[model samples]
Target chain A: MPLIDEILDLAGYRREDLYVCLGCKICSSICVLNEIGIEANPRNFIINLIMEKEELRRDPLLKYCTGCYACTFFCPWEIKVPDMVRAARAALLPSHPFEQAFSSSLELFGRVYEPYLLFRLLPYFFRKGYLRLLVKGLPSFRLSLPKRVKTEGIFDREKK
Target chain B: MRYAYYPGCSLKGSAKGLDEGVKKVFSALGDELVEIPDWNCCGAFEFGEKERILALSQANIRKGREVSSEIIAPCPACLKNLREAADSSVSVLHPLEVFSEASFWDRLPMKRDLGGRPFTPYYGCILLRPREFALRVRDPMEEIITRLGGKVVSSQVKAQCCGGNLFFKELEVSERLAKKVWEGASGDIVTFCPLCHLVLKTFSEKGRRVFYLTDLILYVMGEREFL
Candidate 1:
C-alpha cells in the first residue's frame, strides 16, 4: 500500500484523480505500442490499477513501454502515465534482463557500455543477420575510461 | 569562445561523425571545444529515474570540474541530463542551442552558407520534453535552419519520440517511431540529437537523408559533403 501510494503520489494522481479518466481512451488511441499488437492501452491498464484489480497489476506488457511520454503528452488529463510505467518497471527490474543489465552496467562502469551490451545481446542480433553490426562496431568496442577526469575509482574511494 | 565539450558514449562509437563535425564547425567558427576528459556516458532514457540519471551526470560534472565550468554537448540527451544535474556550479549548453543564439550566429563566418532547401528539423523527444526546456530554447531548429539558408518544414511528428534508447530495447517500437518521422517529413531531415539521427537514418526509406545539425553546419562550412 505504501508503494502504491508513492507511485500514485509521484504522478500527482490521487484516488479522486482516477475519476478524471474520462474513458475517452485518448491515451490508448495515441499509444504506438497499442497499435503494434502490444496490449499497452493506458486507459484500461490505469483503470485496472486504480481500481486495485490485481489481475493486470504487473502485466508483462509493461516492458514494451519505452517511456516516450507520448500518452502523457497527448492525454487531456495531462496524466504522467510514463512515470507510472517507469515506476512499475523499476519494481520489475529484478526480472528483466535488459533493465537489469542497464542497472548493472551503471553500477560497474558508472555508465551503460553500449558495445558491451550489444555484444552480450549478440544472440538476438546474430540470429537476425545483424552480426555485421558487431564487426562494424568492433573498432569502437573497448572499456571506456572517463576522457579527462581521473577519479581514484567509483567504489574505491573512502566514503566522505 | 571556448567551452568544455562532453561527447557522450555514442560520439566515441557510432556517432563519431557528429564528434568530428562539431569539432570542425566549432573550429571554423573560431571557437575551441576542449573535450572533457574522463567523461562518462549521460544516462539517457532512464525516465523518472532521477537518481540514476543524476549520478551519471554528476560523474560527468566531476570530470567537467577538472576542466571548466561551462560545458557544451552536441547531443540533446546529454545536455538535458547534464543540465538537470547541474547546480549553481556549472552551465550546460547544447551546441545547437548555442548556434541558434543570435549573438553566436552574428559571429559566424560570412562565407559559410548552406543552400535554402526546405528541410524538416526533427526535435524527436529529448529536446522537447519537460516543456519548459522547449520554451526556453525558443525553436532553435528553425533558427539554425534559417541561418543555414534552409526552410523549416515541420511535421506532425516533429516533437514526438524517435525511440532513441528503445532502438536496442525494442526494435519494432523504434522502427515505428522513426517511420512516422520519415513519412511526416517533407525533405531531407536534420536533427540535433545523434541518437535521433541514428534511429531515423536506419529506418528512413532509400532516397531520404537525415543529417545531424553539425553535419549540416559542416557541410555549409565546406568542411564536409552534403549529408
Candidate 2:
C-alpha cells in the first residue's frame, strides 16, 4: 500500500492536504507541547512524514502532539498540523479502539454515547490502574446519553 | 421566535444544564425552542479526516433539514461541524446569537445582576478558525453578559485553543493548554462552548470557576435549579 493511502486509512485526511504543508517552523514556535516541555516540533514532524521517514514518525514523543490547532491559527500556509499529527498517531497505534467506538456509535445511533463508552472503557483502565482517570471520569459516568432516534413520526415538539 | 434546537450529545449528557437553561431562557422570552427530531451528534470533535467528518456532518444536516429551516445549536463544536455541512437551505445559529437578537432582549422579563463577578467569554478555536474568513465570528456572549448585568474582563486567550479536542488523546497537553487559558483570563469565567467549559473545569485550579453561558443566564434569571 502507498504511504498516503496508509495515512488516509489510518487518519482519514487526504494526501493532497499533506502536499500543501510548507516546511515552516511557525507551528513549532506556537505549539503548546513544545512550549510546555515536549520536544516533538510540528514542522519537523511534517517534514519527516513528507520524507517518508517512518522511524521518526514512530518516536514516542510524537504522542504528545495534541490537535489543539493553535498552530493552525498562525500557519501562513494554513496547514492543519493537528490533523496530520492525529493521522500520524493513528498510524502508530496497532488498533484505534476509541476511534472504532466513535465510528460504531455514530453508525448505530448517529451520536457518540460518551457515558456508555466510559462504562465500557472503565474496566480496561482499571486493570491498567489509571486511578486518576477513573477519579476524573467517574462524575461524567452519571450523565445520560441522548435518547435514540425515533423515525416514522413528526418532530418531537415541546408545548409551553 | 421558534427555532429547531440542536442540543448535540454534550447538551444531553455532560452539559445538560446548558440545554435546560438555554431552553428556559428562550421560553421566558416567549420564543419556542424545538428539538431537531432524530438529530444525531455533530461528530463531537473534528475527525481531521475529511470524508468521515463530512459524511457525519452531512448526515446531521439531512436530519436537521427534516425538522425546521432555522437550526439553533448551543454547543460550539456542534455548531462548527453542522455549519461546515449545512447548505443555504437552513440557517444555523448559536443560542448566544439568538439571545443577542434585539427582539429577544427587548422581550426579556427582568435582568438579574450577578453581583459583579468578572467574566471573560472564551470562543475556542474550531468555531472561528480555518474557515474564519467566511464564518464572520460574532461576540454575542459579551452582549448577553452585560445585559444580565455582569462585568466583562478582557481576555488574552479569547481566540486561543482550549485543547478540548486533545483531551482524550493527550490529556497532559490538554491540561497545559487549559491552564494556559486560565492563566490569561483569571476570575470566574464563562464560556460559550461546552467543550471549553468541560476542559476548563476539568483542569481548572481551586481559585477558578468555569461556567457554561447558559448557567450564567439561568442564574441571572433567578431559576437556581442548576446542577
Per-prediction TM-score: 0.81, 0.83
TM-score, model 1 to reference: 0.81
Reference interface contacts recovered per candidate: 0.20, 0.38
Residues B1-227, candidate 1: write the lDDT tens digits. Answer: 87899988777766777788888877877888888876766766664454655667888887887688789877777877788788878888777666766676666664566667888888876677655343256677777778788888865667776766676666667778678777778888887777787777777777878877777777776777545
Write one digit per residue (lDDT tens) for candidate 2, span B71-129: 88877777777887888898887766667667876786664577677898887776566
Error of 1 at B218 (Å): 0.7
- Best-performing candidate as measured by TM-score: 2
* Candidates in order: C-alpha RMSD to true structure: 4.3, 5.5
Q: What DockQ does predicted model 2 obtain?
A: 0.31
Error of 1 at A158 (Å): 17
Write down the worst ten-residue block by lDDT for model 2 chain A.
A151-160
Off by over 4 Å in 1: A1-52, A55-61, A74-79, A93-95, A100-104, A132-160, B46-49, B110-112, B133-135
Q: Candidate 2: lDDT over CA atoms?
A: 0.68
